[model samples]
Target: MKFKNLLLSWKYPSILLLGIGISNFGAWVYFIALNLIVLDLTNSALAVAGLYIVKPIAALFTNVWAGSVIDRINKRNLMVALDLFRAVFIALLPLTSSIWVIYSVVFVINMAGAMFGTTSRSYITKLIPIEQRKRFNSLRSLIDSGAFLVGPAIAGILFLIGTPILAIYINAVALFLSGIITLFMPNLEKDRSLEQSDSSLSWKIIKQDWAIVLNFSRQYSYIMFMHFLFSCMMVMATAIDSQEAAFAKAVLFLTDTDYGFLVSIAGAGIIVGALVNTMIVSKIQISFLIGLGSLFVSVGYIIYSFSSSFSIAALGFFIIAFSLAFANTGYQTFYQNNIPVEIMGRVGSVFGLLEACLIIITTTIVGVSAQFISIQFVVITGSIIMFALTILLFILSMKPSKSRYYSVKSVEAKDL
Candidate 1:
């Protein structure tokens, strides 16, 4: 489906995209402010490092069944509620002077995020026509990339004009706006598998659904393995990011302002890549996109890991961020295509839980090890791990996205 068709569709994916883009901008602003607030409150790099662990830690507990809940509820409604919840949480941040309180709030917010993410994906899979999904995903990536590109600059300006507290409340307001916009999104929760009965919260019902998802995952071993590799790559990327402020300040000798500039550079790179994807690019096989994108991403990280100058580091960031556009778009399309809408939530939660566990462990080890080793060295090591895994993933992605999800019916009809 063309962009024109999407705009012309009554569902109005564009409006949903706009809401997400606004929310994402707010998220980036909140993220920057949160780290700064933590740094000010504790004056310890470790404390800031610990803040990175909050999301995964929350996911560890909540993800076990959040998908079940999401699948049962009206996903669009849930997104609006989650947005409001986060808005309230961010609004409360200024009221607390304690880092612990901040941490607790962040934890709750992350739980909301995890649910919102999973539910949104499942909903999108249903809402958009299959033919249009790739374009939709690309557009979504482009908007998200745009947010990253400008979000830091926005945050920096916010900080200059006022305080971190002010930035937080602004983000809260953005969330509320996001929620209001989401209210316009059409609800598409067709799966009554878990909802038809009153047993959505029942332990037995959830356990039975979990077993089905687990069995399905086991049957699709390659998909699960690939997802695991993606999770590892994600963990590594974030592990490196956890120490990024230190890398900027200590190694590159940058101030907070400079660091924001650096981040914006990465965002700009992604925007360029996304633009290329949405505009000039023709349809490419998902496997090829994933494979080539992974290799490029690895190379980018390698350059970033060993950078000695700000310019070199920015170039590295550019490469990584640019390559991510292709890699993530391919993976997301493949995922949405393959997963059955009914089971998408349950199956996704299992992976979400596992990914969270991996992220926590990866971030925890990196955070603690940095205390003993130089932050640069720790980051370099994580990059090395990421490079290796991406190479492996690139090899795996050469295989076609599962045929069963797409063309099997074509060949099957011929058999008849």
Candidate 2:
């Protein structure tokens, strides 16, 4: 089907796609601009890392309640409110010169985002037909990748034209526009018959559903463990990129524009990977694809650690971006396929919580490690660990029970 025609035929799905795409574009712009602002203000790597750390930490604490709220509330309204809240927060960011205020605002923005994100994923399952999930996810990834490809570059240009503060204002306006679009989009009513009739909002639902959650948790334990390992590797590996940018500036005597161009090229790699996933991944066993992707990512990081030249480093970044695209797409599809639609929000939120916790812990560890050891050593060690986990995940994915769940054929044929 033609992409535009596909979207037109699927109205709610189309709205979700557009709203998320626009919002993500704004968010990425804010993210890069905020980091630059922080760095300029503090001139300290630790301060910048701390700003990055706040969101995940906040999500770790608030995700459970957010999940519960998503389960009980109107998903569309929740997302609109969250978007508006984020817009206000972004608008306020430039007004504050205090580091602590920035940290607090970042935490709040992320907390709101976690809530919206869980609901959004669940809503997508409800809105999009099951047979079209692979395509839907591919489209989502493309939008996200496209945003990443353009947002930072735009932010950089805006910063050059005016200031980081002006970029922040633009982000706020974009977010506001996204929220307004969401408000007009069709509201997807939940399957009330599938849920309890009780008006009481207690922890009882979670308590009763604990067994099911535990069962699924046990079944996917290896995937969860691998996620933790991958999270650690990502935290360390990403830190290396930040350090490398500084090193490149100092050693290679590269201009800021050169660094920006290289970063945009890496983003372009992500766009390529997303396009590939959209076109080809539906034909493969998702488990095998995820394992292969992880292996590639680990190899990329390992090579990156040893790279001496800018071209070599850029190649490594390209591979990492490519692998991450496939791996993340495979993993998200696996979750949506396996989990029941009714409990999808809660399940996704729980997973998000776990992911946030792992990221926070890993980022802290890596940030500290960077202070002592070389970024190269950290990247190399993290890559080894990630490689080991990928191997373990591959073995686990081959098991009969796990293999069934991760198979693209099974996912397409089976109902959630």
Candidate 3:
């Protein structure tokens, strides 16, 4: 796509994207700063993991309600309210030094964030046309990835200059600014007629009859399962890397800054991969691309397990980034094209809940496993699982019935 096409395509989504990106950046800043603070205060990996646990749990419960709320409410206003609510919770972080208080605030913030996420995704479907959804979704991912890339780098720099509290204060300011921008977005409301019936609350209307929502889950079951496994491998790698950091310093004589720089290289790779997806993969079939991407990622992680040099590890990180970008683009576009606009919120929320739950379990397992076995072993095992999933997906994709699940058939044909 040309630059003008990409820029013009975002005309309607620009403001919402900007607001969400700013808020996401703030969220990551707070996440990194909070983890650092907790590590300093408690000196316990388990304690830090405890704080992380709040996010998935909050998302799991809040998403069901949030989906229903999104279906019934004004998308723009719901987002604004959620942004303001999250800003308040983030603002409270710097005022407390207690771990319990911090955990509570994190849970609350995640709850509100889940609501915002569901609404935001649903709203985007209404804002953009179906044919252009892939490009738009890719652009959105690029923006979000950019925020993640910049947030931690900036936080680290600010921490070096002042303190963790100072970086946190900056994060709060970013959220406030995000909320302000959200207030200016155009009003985008849902169809009230579908939401107002008394029967809307009944189980059939809320859950059963919505084939759009149901199919989104059922059709992509294999892909989602693979993602869950991939998440586990990622967590295993992260845990290993964390433990290996000190080893690098003591054994290989590398500085902390060198390690940080290597991580930054991975972030750069993610950005590059996202850009490629938006530019090239938007017009292509998603399942084939995703399978190939998974293969790259699985192989990269497997190689990472055997790498003894920083350069080799960096190469592995780049492959992981490429795979993640490809998989995310394909999965997101598959949902956007296949699901009905009216129920996208509910469907997307359900997907989010499942994804969060898997990540939480996987991360926890990896964290706990580190106490017992070598991190290398854990990573290699995770890689094997991912590779196996990729092969399974590849085989499934070759089957007509299974392939149809990922195809974007018209509503009339889909009903048949």
Instruction: Give each model's whole-structure lDDT.
Output: 0.81, 0.73, 0.69
Q: Which pairs clash (backbone N, Cα, C closer than 3 Å) in model 1?
A: none
Put down candidate 1 lDDT per residue, 217-267, tens digits, no spaces: 777677667767877888788878888888888878888888878887887
Per-model root-mean-square deviation over C-alphas: 3.8, 4.0, 4.2
TM-scores of all predicted structures: 0.88, 0.84, 0.82
Native-structure RMSD, model 3: 4.2
Off by over 4 Å in 1: 1-6, 190-198, 247-264, 309-311, 373-377, 400-416
Best model number under TM-score: 1
Tens digit of per-residue lDDT, candidate 3, span 195-257: 343244555555653555566557656544644444444544444454555444543355788
Off by over 4 Å in 3: 1-9, 43-45, 190-258, 398-416
| Tens-digit lDDT string for candidate 2 (1-416) | 69988657678677778888888888888888899899998999889978766877888877765666576667777777788889999899998889999999888888888787787887776676656776777778899899987887788789889988888888899888888988877677643322433355567866555454566567656545655554554654555554666555644456888777667767878999999988996786777666677778877877666677778777877898887777776666766666666666666677677777766666567556756875556656666776676776667656787666664332221232
Please give the ranking of all candidate structures by TM-score, highest first, separated by commas. Answer: 1, 2, 3
Pairs of colliding residues, candidate 3: none
Order of the predicted models by lDDT, top scorer first: 1, 2, 3
The total number of steric clashes, by the backbone 3 Å criterion, in model 1 comes to: 0
Candidates 1 and 3, the one with greater TM-score: 1
Number of the candidate with higher lDDT, 1 or 2: 1
TM-score of model 1 relative to the true fold? 0.88
